[model samples]
Target: MAWPTGASPYGIGVRDAVVRGVGPRSTDGVIRVWYPAHVPSSLAARRYFDGPDELQIMTRGLGWLLSARGVRALGGWRTRGHTNAPPAAGRLPVVFFSHGFTGFVGQNTHLCERLAAAGYLVISIAYPEAAASICAPDGSSNVMSAAQRRRLVGDQFARAMVRLLRARSIDAENRAISEVTAVDTLARENDRWSVHLTAMLDALVPIDQRRARVDTATAAILDAGDWSRVALMGMSFGGSTSANVAHLDERARAAINLDGMQQGDILLGQDIRVPLLVMSSAGSMLPSGRVVNDLHYESRRTATGRVQRVLVADAGHYAFSDLVAFGARRTRGLLDLGTVDPERMLTLVADTVTAFLGDALEPGGDSGTDETEVSP
Candidate 1:
């Protein structure tokens, strides 16, 4: 689906590149970057999880038992800037992006690209730890958890996701979801990803800290001298991590959770001094989803700065993903990307994200940049 770039004074250009030093997975895990690229070469967008015989993998993998194809790139690859492209005139806000469980760094490119266009340097990290698998640039892929696959596999599971996502009866949906037990799964993964916030910040910011193995070559590409303008954002499981991590990490200026359910430490209680934006699918914001998210939002609202919650009407758990637009509309794949007007949802999600980030990071910027600015 085509997402819009708002009429900001800054013209938007994009380039996707990779960085390592986070973990030991040369292809196991890598950080993906979507920065402002004024002039980029037209390189064909390549697939990290789609092909079996390619040379290397630049991202994470999400799929069912049969297919491992990550969301296929539908020709926005021109954003891949040449190595060491110039940063926009000034130091832009640095946004740390974490994708949902079993999702690639590019899983939420629609949002990342939009944020980049709005003058933010968005970086996403994908690892095989919480994902089904990660692939090498040589096209050789490996599975991280056969157990995760078993838990998510089968016609029964797909129907469960579809029912929980598309069910008319909220009670039935809640029961089905409870039976599945993915919330615990999500929370654990969120914790795994969240703990890395300090490490991620250590690498991105110019501060001297004992860091993960710094990917010196890739680190050179980053120009983030301003540690004050940092934010954490993620979708689904990633969203949960953003919320929990924002509470745990002192450096996060703000955090946004896009339709991710709260569990684990967030439920036990966490501190929050950072502004948080929690967005949910209108449909799934009920029963357990609402119960957890509302409590988290309200608690954080009291503990810290602003905690804004908005619902994307006519959307589902997967609405924040590109799967709905690029992948098949139906629940044909491993993920039940429910049917929504992909274009409309993308527009709504992107607009809300841009506004929220602007309000939180920009000095003298009003919080009116939120969903209130975007007509329902």
Candidate 2:
């Protein structure tokens, strides 16, 4: 439950808002936004898991003793952001974050805090339907979707999808994946999340009065964001969401997917022209023992865009998330976190992502920060 001590100078501020999506395919959405802010020394930082619903989601309904212990540990941890603090001066770049499937909004709070400290407005979107659980300020928790819950616990549909992910080649993967109509469910879900991402963008549009209402704090924070310089980033299924949103939204100058297997129509010949950096752990292997970049390889081969790939050494699937820093100590066997030091992994990930986004969104690029650098 430890948080990363980031190097940025700006104090962080966070606020949450629920907005109804204006898109025909969109749904009501919850977003937690972190931004650079002015904080007084006397301000008290908020708890990591602040309320009942968040605590329930984090502890998985407090079903296991280990989980309860983890929650107790988390209770002592504090976030870097002050709730609804004054926004820092100057319009900053915007970056949207999506969480993995079955993950709640704050799953990657460490990364979001790091980005917010680095002077970007970071909006972490919550997909209540697909998330393990998401508690809104209104005291309602949207639990996991029954269909997605079945998929997670290994129904026939889930097994078939896993088999497709292990296919030896793109053609083989695509051919097999096409036979399953249920794959459309992923496409539909991706569309929903992507639409939610765009809806957040719509909220920032100064003239979009027809969209959801923005509160005073939300308005001030959104106003400080330079929407023209926007990027998308996420972990796990959230990573897949980032890639798909970048492909569909022309405003996305760059995207980073942290170790998620690709899903959605992005695998079915849709070209992504945005600059994308796909970071992988050392362990994404196919059935034939070849360690592949999965969608990264396919995007590099056919997509007319700047695509860079990096594989972190001694890392596992969950290493890109905050789960590595906290729950890994107790749930290591279940979560399969990488062997790298949690703090070091968090620093490496934050540095790499910050460097990439700085170069992609800022003028003249981020001087000499090595976007490809990784720690041993």
lDDT of 2 by residue, 56-169 (tens): 655763234235777667645788878888889878898989888777677778888988998899988877567766666666566665465656443545766676666877
lDDT of 1 at 297: 43
lDDT of 1 at 193: 69
- lDDT per prediction? 0.59, 0.70
Q: Which regions of candidate 1 are displaced past 4 Å?
A: 1-3, 6-21, 40-60, 63-85, 133-142, 150-188, 207-217, 267-271, 287-291, 300-305, 327-335, 364-376
TM-score of each: 0.73, 0.84
lDDT of 1 by residue, 86-194 (tens): 5556577889888776666666766776777677877777655665455544444565555664543566556656666665665676565554444444445555666
Best by lDDT: 2
The TM-score of candidate 1 is 0.73
